[model samples]
Target chain A: MAGTDHDKPLITGGPAIILVEPQLGENIGMVARAMANFGLSELRLINPRDGWPSEKARAAASKADHVIDGAVVFDTLEEAVADLNFIYATTARERDGFKPVRGPEEASRRLRTRNDAGERTGILFGRERFGLSNEEVAMADEIVTFPVNPAFASLNIAQAVLLMSYEWMKSGFGAEQTPFAGPDVMPASKEHLNGMIGHLESALDARGYFRPAAKKPKMLDNLRAVLTRPAFTLEEIKLLRGIISSLDYFSPKTPRGSGNPERKAKVDRDRHGKSGETVKDEER
Target chain B: MAGTDHDKPLITGGPAIILVEPQLGENIGMVARAMANFGLSELRLINPRDGWPSEKARAAASKADHVIDGAVVFDTLEEAVADLNFIYATTARERDGFKPVRGPEEASRRLRTRNDAGERTGILFGRERFGLSNEEVAMADEIVTFPVNPAFASLNIAQAVLLMSYEWMKSGFGAEQTPFAGPDVMPASKEHLNGMIGHLESALDARGYFRPAAKKPKMLDNLRAVLTRPAFTLEEIKLLRGIISSLDYFSPKTPRGSGNPERKAKVDRDRHGKSGETVKDEER
Candidate 1:
């Protein structure tokens, strides 16, 4: 789970991640990892520091070998993005208003839309210390900035890559579905729920737990409200009924902690009668 | 710009960030920096490896001293989140259908809503390599997972922290506004656009650019459509008119490539006549 699974299909193809003069090979590796996590496979580097074929980056990639291995290098930023139809330059610093600046989410949507239309789009990241130059920003069609605390907006290269990659993935695949789904249990039928509630009420009535007769109706209403709110599953309703049955019949005088076996058997028979067939008949 | 600004107000009091037995001090530092970037200040660490007060973490925090300095440590994850009314456990691996699982965006919204309602909430991040155990996840009210590639779902501790922090910031501040606004030039007046189109049409007419007399109207419509699509600015319209004027009157025989000076003077005079006063009068 901590490393790559070569057997599973590697999701590829999205906007190119263009790094303009990225300083550290380790940063490049982390960027590759982030890109891999979000299914962005295209990596373009414009004059990376210490040249290409970086072992440091490969090690940092943490087994995202495909991205690091497929990374393309260029002598200039223009050459790197020459074939791209649209480009976005990422920056933390404010510039003299020229290109339209978009937050990451909007920019990701635009990039995804353009990409869907068969247009090649890329986002440019700057040098490790000083972000994209003014000339570099001008080269892009638009600017994208992270919505961060303006006072401490400096995000490391990999962190920036993670945000854009995350947003790009969310834009294309949507933000609704996670890697896995939640539990898929259905709500319990009202008949089963009312049966459980009635059983509990009867037990409470025997114990005189509803207080004075004048307030019994209000207390029942409150009890019903609480029980109805959870929308419990069929299994949960059965469990509740079992608990009520145990409380109503079991005592220290019982032969064992197993409670009255006859009552338990009756409870099991009643639960079966209330399930599947009965529920379907009720629906009909 | 790379470091913290102590003089600036530190944004605090969002959901608490609870890290369970995090292995690396550098990762903790990075998490702190990511939190600071997105205005999340409260940090709760549950038994970090290598103990607390590590110099490596401080250096990695990149001067996000406020977050690192104010970080609280707990002996257990339960104790770390003892006061929180709501909790979300982050996991990369799928679990055995129990708690409700939400994607980061939805989870962020829920966290923000609970926080706004004056209820304390926290997000639980697990160890660097092993992640949170099932027992640890079972301690939370809900499961929150990233929408990452199923084949490569592993996200470093810092990256996980960054995504949660980013979504939290976006949930509160919104994604509509970037750090700065774009250029604010007004759209060109329709009268000005019409005037420029008419001048260009006249020039083309003089050159017999619309061949075949029967197609003249269609050709004129096509010309107007292309010119009208951009919604050009006032300055852009003026530049377009100037270009057209130069094309209509200039010749290789003209001295100093200045275009016919007499015609240029007339063009200037006509442009003045089509200015603010003329536009306002026409509107009336």
Candidate 2:
């Protein structure tokens, strides 16, 4: 999980995450890792508890070295956020009600829009125990709070960062495109499905799975309905056919092609010996 | 951050968080805390690496004691998820693409829908070092992955839990209502704004701020536009009038009432002696 892909571009540049008097180096490191996870790189520290060049922070960042290495420290919060045009103060406590309150999603959207418009924006996070003071909250353009369980609303510094960073990433990049695409196999063709169904019916007929002869067609219809409902892919149909073949004829106790030698030979050829072109030709 | 409100009902039940062979008691504790922050209380463990009842986990959970106390342990992933009607496997690495894949938002929405329908659902997370194996992922109904930076895709166990829990909370409850409401101050009345503007203009006139008599109206118009644009609150207008009064005539070096005694008295009374009713009467 700590591995970093140097070959891929290290996506940087988002709202600066300004930590105002963060207490622990480990927390700071974790914050950097969270920020990096969501493509944020700018980190500004306002009077860190332990002075700059913290080994604990470096170690905790896991491989988000760029975020830590590029971190800028300021003596005061004012200086830390001096260059940013828009600022959001993150707090759990209620303030004197001068500023507008926003939830994380709205705040992230605003930040992303402003960032896109070429305005620098930042989100201010407070100390570990007590959050941003009334005065600090007043400095920001607006207030942003997470919709946490009101009773247990206090999120750890890093958890807060992870949440906001996630929203920021989602707002900017969207959540539709996963990092990697899923399997591209097509759904089973009706013809392919019918072939599998016919083969399975023959196997079941040999085993007398359709109990009463009068109920055989109804039982076959039920089996087909169950099998067709899943919309099995070509690969799945092939696997199901293999399973049926193994159950009916592949057991060592029974010789492989003892029953219906010609059909068994055809199934065997399709299963193990047919090439992609031959399979397509047979499908045609 | 560690405080919990015992008086309030503890929010229990969401998608069960199934950790498969999770290592580190601290991570388990952090995961529990994250879950508590978002109101998810169900925690199911499938063979935790170190034995259960870990003090480290309890300490790490901050005040999310209920989550830790209610955690259930199972011998296998199948046993852990036996009762759940739907399951989502969280993975940072790519799989062979058998199951459908979803981003966190989509996954959370699906889980919320299922949970609301009275179906038991769970999210599966894997070991800290390596994520859910292909086999473990295959056991779930679908795969859920974070939309993270492709270069730094890996997220530590707790961070991953925090992200998904946040999404779950947002999906169910929405992110519109912040925990606390903002200030309820109304916009200043036009009469109130004009009074402050006129008072400041008189002060400027007394000090010859409008250099030429011919341009005084234009100067007054510019000043009015600048002051009116902010749409200051009633309190803000009152504060501004006080500032104008202080700057024009309240210096200790000069007598308080020497410039304009009647106006001085009105300003002083409004600044320090008026009650809410008195202010309303004046506005009327």
Candidate 3:
């Protein structure tokens, strides 16, 4: 009864973690700890490196043995995720698919809501050695990745699950208030983005991006998907469009291409006047 | 005369940044700033926010004024890229194309080789407002992307430029080298990787990972990529894989989905196990 919709906890309430082909008992243990840290207790392991009830994992779990004991092990991602209504695949590499990929925070946010809805949701984490395969990613409705230092993007197994869980919990547990102040308050609503899209379409059409008549609709959808993925709130959108309109008025491109050539070739070097580093060097 | 490579004594001489239809002057300025910080100065704007030579952009460029002022505007990416022999396009969304895609570091690595050959190369970043159109991405040889937070995949134009520039500079300069020891030796070689991979693969084979027959190749590739991406030195990789193997032998995933569900969860609170914060009750 406690696991029922309204009675369930916010962040950990919905999704289960399905680790496919994990190779290390320690990583399993660490992952369990991370999961517990993020409030998620339901775990499913498919082909773990060490067998379950691992002493090594038990030794490493810290306070998360509860999560480990509760974790389920399976043989494949498909069977692991079959029980869930919404499935998210976690990966470190780009996969071939049409799935909407989001970072950990976004994934958590979406998953948190599903929990509130009482939907059985799960996140599939691939093996510690590799990650989820393309086929595996295709099975999920979404893909979750993390923004890490590009110079060093090899996040540990436990780190990945932990970071995602952190964000999901923070975003979904009525923790919208932040420690650091962001630019604005509200997330861009769908209607607000639609207005922005209309403006952008007009601008594109004027520039002939709609080119052939038959391609217009498809182009619009593509443009919309790319531009409006995470909608920008009204202020941000308005400010951006304002900047675009101003630039168009001043240095607009041609009908088929962007505006003037002379203006385009200039390195906008006027920022620091003639004093910036070597201004003349930039002036070809 | 200006288009000549000699015209600009490029800070670190990596790749030029060409931004198309970037909607925010602040963002363009920021991109310039991002480039400048990483010793990248060539900034090309196809179309920008707030007009060329925008004072607002200059002011916002922070320390990137040198990059902002030297920025070149282009009517199209083609015109902007005319001087470069190789090109890479950056997009947040997946482009429907067959072009080989590379992460930012790899993109820079290729460009560094071309640069060493004295071949002019440039990296193109799409507008923050709409990103590069699929057509634009198609015109390029490779797609450059960041391993970013999936939920907040959008990088400010400058942020994206900075990320690529950082990778390009890091590689071109060969920063320290992987397993970078201050006064000690650099990392191991490709030969070392082969041996290590062979060893690990054999170890994994012994564990029954080659199961299902169809999954072997993908699993191997996935493991190889994860281990090699950060290019771990002999010690690092050895330490990592060693830990993994040790854990595997201890406890593996339960053979079936649920292995004795009634079993009591074990507890281990090792100090090495970093269970820093509790994720459960932070409802705020």
Q: What C-alpha lDDT values do all the predictions have?
A: 0.72, 0.72, 0.56
Runs of candidate 1 with Cα error greater than 4 angstroms are A1-7, A206-208, A212-214, A242-249, A252-284, B1-8, B174-284
lDDT of 3 by residue, B1-284 (tens): 00112234446456788888878786676666556545677788886755798877887675455677788887877789887888998877776769888876568788888988999888877765677788888888898775443322334465466557656655654321221112222455766566556545543443344445577787566656534543445444343333322222222233222343322122111112222211121110
Tell me the TM-score that candidate 1 gets on chain A alone. Answer: 0.82
Off by over 4 Å in 2: A1-3, A250-284, B1-6, B174-284
Per-residue lDDT of model 3, residues A156-259, tens digit only: 46656765655555564454423433222233433334445554454444444454677665545444433433324445555444322322222233444445
Per-residue lDDT of B1-284 in model 1, one digit per residue for the tens?
A: 24335577767779989999988899999999999899999999988889998799999998888899999999976467656656788988876534678988888887776677666778999888788876676656678888887677668989999999999998786553233332243345445665666565544443344556676665454444334433355656654454344334322223222344354354344434343323211100
DockQ of 3: 0.01
Ranking by DockQ: 2, 1, 3
Candidate 2, residue A106: lDDT: 84
Clashing pairs in 2: none
Per-candidate TM-scores read 0.73, 0.74, 0.33
Question: Which 10-residue window in model 1 chain A sums to the lowest lDDT?
Answer: A275-284
Worst 10 residues of 2 chain A by lDDT: A275-284
Task: Count clashing residue pairs in model 2.
Answer: 0
Q: On residues B1-284, what C-alpha lDDT tens digit does candidate 2 reach at each position? A: 33456577777788999899999999999999999999999999988999898899999998788899999999987678756656788987776645677888778887777677676778999999888876576556677888888788759889888888988888776453234332233345444555665565554443344545776655444444334433355665654443343333321222222354355445444433222222221210
- The alpha-carbon deviation from the true structure for residue B248 of candidate 1, after best TM-score superposition, in angstroms, is 99
Candidate 3 ranges beyond 4 A from true positions: A1-284, B1-10, B175-284
